[model samples]
Target: MHFCELGDPGELSPSQILIRTEFSGITNGTERHAMLGEFNWNHFPGRHGYQHVGIIEATGNEVEGFNTGERVFYGAYVGHRAWHIVDTENGPPLLITLPDGMDHPYCALFGVAGVGLRCVRRVRVRPAQKVWVVGQGLIGGFAAQAARAYGAHVTVTDIDENRLSLARSCGTHRVLDACDERVFEQLKEGGPYNIVIDGSGYKDLFFDIQEHALLARRGVIGALAVRGETTFDWSMLHQRELSVEVSCHFAVEDLTILRHFVREHIIHIKPVVSHRVSIDEAPDIYTILRDRPAELLGVIF
Candidate 1:
């Protein structure tokens, strides 16, 4: 990925706010997908990313509740940049003030974490239910936490031991090594999960779940990862009466709830952050993201 010299954000309108970005988070999965042209909607010379934590540099006369100099987390369909002009009154974008003394760098992943929160909410996770998350990337890590916060008995699996360890530290009830030969047997012992959240974006894993009969009757499958297509045996889903749920980008309501969770320390962001680099190093980071994703998580600039 290459950075372009976008000209300065011009003067704001009466209902606008100018934010000077302090940190912006890289969305590893989505950005990598875009770079690889995995999505049909991707185009040449496009911008990607929606996470930004910045300080309000100035505000228009009609802007209320938000004042100049306040630190905030704002998300829009914009690229990683130094400045953002937000129209609060007619918004496709939204911003929220940061909590007192919240760590600025960690807040860069707020949008990523919000996606996890939205997925759990969309799948309707309930207290005391068993939920299995099949990945330990940033989104999966946060998904495990969100499920636990919703009172589910959460189990997370990943081939990466580091990620599994992080899941344990995040208070997951169980962590399984997907690389283990007997992993499926182990999963069967924990059988008939109430919900299975696919954060791995692996079609084979989804097929395996069905072939192994891992889900209970009427179990919900939450597909939070980006994938081109998912093809599986129809009989398996038909027999179990299973339902597949998909969630895209998060809503402002999801972010509001996520902020509360982050403030209360219910969802840990710092542990998931494996890299922190300056904006100048972004191109190099994107190289690593495309070539060796296993080496990174929660990268901020």
Candidate 2:
């Protein structure tokens, strides 16, 4: 934390974009995972950094679809304040032209929502298929809702009863306490599940259930939780024919579809939001995210 009376606008070159940030949303999963000293982006494309809506102060020589004073979205995990300069490489795969009816906060949730969309898309959910979502913070909540949009009968599981309440309100069939004794009984009778999405940031379930895992036939697992260390038994997934995947950030092409969804209101990604703050307040807010994370889906500034 440095004390400064003022700061300078950042700099960038071609295929680059410079934005005066108006607002950004905190990705609780990734941000919290990063804070726990358990972050693991070691060999991947690294992390999402951060993305939010801002005014275009400058555009790189090679950039297009953006102009001075234009509002657009871009991401960088560490983030930039006052003014941020990012090469088009860091910008959205494509620029977003905010419609007149939308709010910047809703725009900020786009990146996160895109990931959820991708997860649901991959599920290829069959109409009336039973789906289980294992968390409901931001990612899990979005996944649960998206599954519903895909016409699946969805259920959400979370340790927090309050978050469970939100999931129920968000259209889940039922909430399960994975930490309780009654959890197994709640498993739909006659079978385990056609699909199971694990948004929890832990691998303990995989380890513990490997013994009696035959319960879920043709099961699938999605690890969207942003925790540090998670374990999996590859052979189990192979034996059970469970399709396992991880949900990441949105791809460049997905923006148009998401924009359309947001525009048409066919999908709802707004409920997870629980806080709003400013850039100057981000550092302190980061601590609040680490110590007490529950129902606090987004921190916008």
Q: How well is each residue in 1-301 modelled by candidate 1, as lDDT tens digits? A: 6777768888899999999999999867888888888889899888988899999999999888899989999878688988999987865457888967777789999998999999999999999999999999988999999999999999888999999999999999989999999999889888779999999988797689887889989999999998776797888779889989999878888988998888888999999988999999988998999899888898999
The candidate that achieves the highest TM-score relative to the unseen native structure: 1
Error of 1 at 126 (Å): 0.9
In model 1, the clashing pairs are none
| Poorest stretch of ten by lDDT in candidate 1 | 88-97
Please estimate how well model 2 matches the true structure, expressed as its whole-model Cα lDDT. Answer: 0.68
| lDDT of each candidate versus the true structure | 0.89, 0.68
RMSD in angstroms between candidate 2 and the native structure over all alpha carbons: 3.9
Leading candidate by lDDT: 1
